[model samples]
Target chain A: MISFQHVTKIYPRNTIAVDDVCFDVEEKEFVSVVGKSGAGKTTLLKLLLAEEKPTQGEIFFQGKSINEIKPGNLPEFRREIGAVFQDYKLLPSKTTHENVAYALEVIGASDQEIARDVPKVLEIVGLTEKANNFPEELSGGEKQRAAIARALIHRPEVILADEPTGNLDPYHSLGIIRLLLKIQEMGTTLILATHNREIINSLGKRVVTLEDGRVIRDERRGRFIL
Target chain B: MFTSLKRVIRSGWQGFFRDGGLSIATVFILLLTITLATSLFLFHGLSHLLISSVEEKADISLYFKEEALENDIFEFREELARISEVKEVKYISQEKALADFTEKHKDNPVLMASLAEVGRNPFLASLNIIASEPGQYQAITDFLETSDFTALIEKVDYYQRRSVIERIFSLTSTINRSFIFLSIILSLVAILVTFNTIRLAIYNSREEIKIQRLVGAGSWFIRGPFLVQGVLAGILAALICLLTFSLIIWSLSPRVETFFTDLDISQFFVTNLWQIILIQFVTGILLGVISSFLATRRYLKI
Candidate 1:
């Protein structure tokens, strides 16, 4: 459902974040972008999210050019793709429930739907008891789970998660990976970027490996190999 | 759309209250600006009152000889009144002048005895001329000196009082110009200070704004709450300023009256109540809303 064709991103002062990399993911496919730190995995997801324009090349989602999307249409375009971050970028001012509801809120969902779906998603992520807690009050795992719930609440066509469990413990990490697997099973495209080798090997799904801003490997059911 | 707007307002209200210290600081800065604006308005009025009172004391009086007929003096008064520059011309008869003098000095025995010794209504019949402006007195004096009735005139007091009239004129204009200049500078400074304070406050939330954008929230959706907060703060500041101003004007009115009995400041305040309210509220709300709009625009670029 998403395509990155010869995408390259360069920052100021001659920093090549992602260089001439290309990849594509099928609908409902759970693609893990495996790389060490500074491997351009996050940059690749950011380009897909249109958070940053590619220094060179074009990204397409559902056969539409992401680079051509105008500023006024960006919000509508973004609502179709749910995004989760390593830091669990929940609105600190909002409780867990409000944070999840925010995703639906942006789409102009009915109040009944928000009141209905927010709790359902919060329950799916096992955060029902902590629905009213702010991000500061949540544990790392809970925070990540809350982020996942927000990502899932909108039921977008794809979920792009960047280092979602980077700060979680191994036990919490496994639980997050399991939750992600369950989400993928429920027919949502997933692109997870992480440097964690164990989680990659355990998932044994489609893996696009990056090294020095270049895609070194792309394999169906690939192993975590440097 | 209505639901979204309601949500935006709710979110803003929550943000304002949740950010206790920041909200208070923002309101405090806005209050200072509104207060300055209202004070400037009142000061403009007060200065006008002061200048006009001084102008009242600076008229020129023309003394007529005893031989000048009442018809000639009345006709002369009519001619002076027709001049555009002359604000007023009152013909004070010799007898009335003497009566006024006696009435004024009735409590002083020395002035009473001196007046009685002179005994035959020594005061001259005179025309008191008030020019619309201090500088116009010179022209009116010139008219009197060149008039056909100059033979009947004893003296025109303009030359004697020219320096004081010119001084009053210059002083009023200077006061007016200086006040306008000071008002502009003070207003600019207040606007800059208030803008920066709000910008810095929004800077603290720059990260939150980015995250909201990345999460697919629209620009207005994210900005709406901040604008709402701005409106709330502005309204509160204006209300507080209005109350404070009312109390202050009330307490100071008695003192002001003691010095300038002709000026009833409290009555003036009551008369201009709606105008002052409009100025304060408009200023307060515009400052808050515009500052928030600009500050958020910088961060909403994502």
Candidate 2:
């Protein structure tokens, strides 16, 4: 459902973060983008989200050029894809439930739907008990779970998870990976960008590995290979 | 649309209570601004009252010679009244002026004896000419000096009193101008301070704003709460100021009257109560809403 045509992103001082990369993911596919730090993995997802424009080439989502999305319509475009970052990105002042419910609220969801869906999603993330707690009051795992709950609340067509488990312990990291697997099994497209060796090796799913800003390998049953 | 608006307002209300420190700080800044603006508004009126009282003391009196008939003095009074520059003209007969002088110095034996020594009615029938403006007195005195009946006038007191009148005129204008300048500076300071406070509050929420944008919240959805917060602060500040001013003005009226007997400030406040409330309400709400609106716009671009 998403395609990148010879995309390149060059920063100031001539740094090539992504160099003429090309890839596509079909609807409901689970794609793992593997790279070490500075391997252009994050930059690829950022292009899809339209957070940054590629210095050259084009990106398309559902066959529509993402660059063509007007500023006025960007919010609607974004509502189609959910994002979970390494930092959790939960509002510090909002309670766990409020953070999750915010996604629905922004779209003018009815009170009954929000009341019904927020808790169900929180339950899926196993954070139903901590619904009223603020981010600062939650543990690292709880905070990550809350962030995941928020990303899944609206049942977005695609979930772009960039280094979501970067700050977790081995157990919590594995738990998060399994949660993502559960989400993928439920037929949601998942684009995971991470440098973690175990996650890429164990997933062994459609892997597009990047090395020095170029995609070096693409395999259906890929493994982590330096 | 109605559903969206209701949600936006509720979100704003929640955000207000959620961010305690920022909300309190915003309300405090708005309150400070409202108080300053309201006081300056009232101060402008009070200064006008004081200036007018001083102006009342500077009118020129034309005392006619004892030989000038009452009819001539009355005719002169009628002519002076016709001058648009003149605010008022008072005719005091010779007998009335003497009676006034005796009544004023009744307890002062020296002045009483001096007045009695002058024997007969020594006072002249006079026409007191008060001009609309301090500068206009010059025109009135010039008319008096050049009049055909100048021969019947003993003296135009404007020349002798010109220095005092001129001093009052300059002093009133200076105070009037300085107050206006000071009010402008204070208002600017108030606006900048509130703007900075709101900017800082929004800056604190920058990361959340970025996340919210990515979460698919529309710009208005994200900004709704802050705007509501601003308008809420404005309403609160306006109410507080209104109650405070009303109580203060009502209670302080009698006490302030002792210092300026003719100026009943309490009565003025009572009469203009609605107008004052409206000004404060509009000022507080506009400042609060506008500053928040601007502060949020800079961060919502993401």
Candidate 3:
């Protein structure tokens, strides 16, 4: 479980990226953060990932304040939370298998574990055939799947997908949405930030809508309403 | 710990080969820097040899009075040896001096006739004196002037050769200073160029680094490979430079020895083979690793 208590992030030049906003996600819940451009959705996720500290407030992961977490312990914290991005963030030089195995390798997984889990995860993403293919060699959908495989290989407790389907076509986007739903069914908490109205309307999950750095609405089984 | 090390090395190996062209280029530049460093090191050794050789050639000759007894001069020689400044003293008797002159002009009839005409071994008995340090020559000269046997002394050749000795001393000092300055400047340039080259190589992998951080890699895990690559570059460069220098010295030794009869550069290198290799290896590896570490540190920070 994760909680944000009145977190605010202000960049230089007096720009408020995220205002004093607060939210929480229960264990195994699928939460969607919906907003147009400049809604502070990405800023919220960044704070959760500890990529940037909240300018003024605290973030809690599993009852521990993430803001007080030492830098040396960040890798351990990050290992428990998987992140997928819009750009697919796969290492270009690495094959799909290597990319997936990388996540486990970072956590010092055994070679046997890497070999076993990587193939299994790739298979789940329907990318087993493209295991040896580099990111450049894969299609957009395949690349996204590879990224997903990397994010899920370690079986992280929480998965944060920030516009993961932003660059995909409608068919690929639908496939990714279905993949997210399947992952959620497996009991992994999912926090997806997107402006994709069709996916939001289709999911009918808990939605948190933001407008100009403030959370304007929070609804249970909400629709894509501005 | 072993597992971490194994993983780091494995990832390093993969990263090295994965960025093939850029990695090779980084290694090559490291090679060049190593080669220059090795050459400078060898040149420094050679300079020391040349300086000592020049110092050995510059000694003062002390001529004794015509009536001065050989026994007294020998006793003076013993006393001179006791002085801390005097490195060595050679006694050249009047008879030996005359014989040396005759032996030199035996084939030249006119010169032999001129030497015979002078007759009666005109050369004076002398003591050739060398100082432990060039600056200490003045101390030895002062000692000779104030010695108890000063009355038996005919002339000290030091005053006549003072200017030449001074010139040689200053020349060697200038050479040493210039060599050190030049090496420092070149080393800085080499390090900067090498650092920038590796930085560019790392810059090309920025996306990979970001991705690695995103996937929860510790800083060391991502940096280990680049560091290994740097060390590899250093080792390869050092080996190449060693071979090149050995070959060059081997080929040029005979020709150089022809001009400077006592100096055999090839023999010197061979005699100190292990030391030469060690210096080159350490220099190469140090430059490679240090430059790579500095260049990659900033980028690896997640």
Candidate 4:
């Protein structure tokens, strides 16, 4: 359902963020992107989200080039895919429930649907008790779960998580991994980028490993390999 | 569409109330702008009143010759009054002029003694002419100097008082022009300061705007709340400014009237209450809305 064709991203001062990367994922498949710090993992997601224009090559989602999408249509296109960042990126002013409901709210979802779906998703993320708390009041694990709930609130076709567990403790990291697994099992395509060897090796899923700015290995049922 | 609008408004209201510090800062800046605007308006009116009162003191008196007949002078008065530039023309008889001179000099022993020695009411009968504008005095003087009654009139005093009249003319126009220039400059400064304050406030929320964009919020959907907040802040500031002005004018009216007896600023305010409300609301809302719209635009591109 998604393809990256020889995409090369160059930042200022001759920094190569992503070099000639080519990849594809079938519908409902979960793919893990493994890389060290500054391996261009976040840039890949940003390019796909149309937050940054690729310096070279094209990114396609279901056949249409992402770069060619009109500026006005970017929001509509983005609603089809959810994203979670390492920073949680929750609206600081909104409560946990409002943050989750914001996804549905943007799409002009009916009040009844938001009232129903937001709570149900919060419950799934096991954050029902802290629905009214702001992000600052939540623990690291709770904030990640809140981010997950927001990503899953509208049932997006794909979820691009960039180091979602980077700030969590080992116990919380494992919990986030299990949450991603549950989300994938429900048929949403998941693209998870992380550097944690334990989490990557434990998944035993398809992994695309990056070194510097190039993908060095891709294998089904891959383990974390340096 | 209506539902979406309602949601945006509700979200904005919530955002405005929840972000107390930012909201207060925005409102304070907006209040300053509205207050400046209202002050300029009042100053414009007061300045006009003051200039007009000063100009009223400037009029040309035509002193009739000693042998000039009362009938001829009265006829000349009628003719001068017909000129559109002339605001008023009053004929003062010789007896009345003498009486006025004595009354004015009653407290001055030297002036009173000089007037008594001249004994037979030596003051000349004259026509005091007032013009609608100081500049129009020249036209009226030209008319009188070229009139048929030049034979009956002895020395229209316009030539002797020409310098003083011209000074008053230049002084009033200069004051008027300076006031307008100052108002324009102050207004520009107020707008710039208010815009920057709002821009800073929006800069703090730039990240949130980007997040909203990434989460699929349409441009207006994200901007709508800020606009609503702007409207709310504008309304609050306007109401507060109105109350402030009302209190200020009420307290200062008596003191101001003491200096300018003809102008009752409190009365002017009461008469123009609706207009003042309209001006305040328009100034407050436009500044708030436009500033927010521009400030939020830089972040919405993401």
- Candidate No. with top TM-score: 1
TM-score of 1: 0.97
Chain B TM-score of candidate number 4: 0.87
Chain B TM-scores of the candidates: 0.95, 0.90, 0.90, 0.87
Q: Report the CA-based lDDT of candidate 2 relative to the real structure.
A: 0.88
Clashes of each: 0, 0, 1, 0
lDDT of each residue in B120-191, candidate 1, tens digit only: 789899999888876787788888878888899898787787887788889889989999999999999999
lDDT tens digits by residue: candidate 3, B1-302: 67778877877777778888887887788778877877787788887888889888888899999999999999999999999999999999999998898788789999888877986678999999989887899889888788998999999888998999899999999999999999999989988888889888888887788778767888888888777877777777788888888889989999999988778898789888898788777876777677767776776666
TM-score of 3: 0.93
Higher-scoring candidate on DockQ, 1 or 3: 1
TM-score of each: 0.97, 0.94, 0.93, 0.93
- lDDT (Cα, tens digit) per residue for candidate 4, span B1-302: 98789989999999999989999998998899889988888888777877777778888988989999999888888988889999899989999998898788789999988877876788789999999877898899789778999987777788998898788778878888998899899999999998998899889999999999999999999999999999999999999999999999999999999988988899888887898899889988888889999999999988
Q: Which runs in model 1 stand beyond 4 Å of their true positions?
A: none
Give the alpha carbon lDDT tens digit for every residue of A115-204 in model 3. Answer: 788888888999989999999999999999998888888999999999999999999999999999999999999999999999999998
Off by over 4 Å in 3: B65-67, B102-122, B147-154
For candidate 2, what is the interface RMSD?
A: 1.2
Structural similarity of chain A in candidate 1, as TM-score: 0.99
Error of 2 at A123 (Å): 1.2
DockQ of each: 0.83, 0.75, 0.68, 0.80
lDDT of 2 by residue, B49-95 (tens): 87788777788988899899999888888888988999999999998
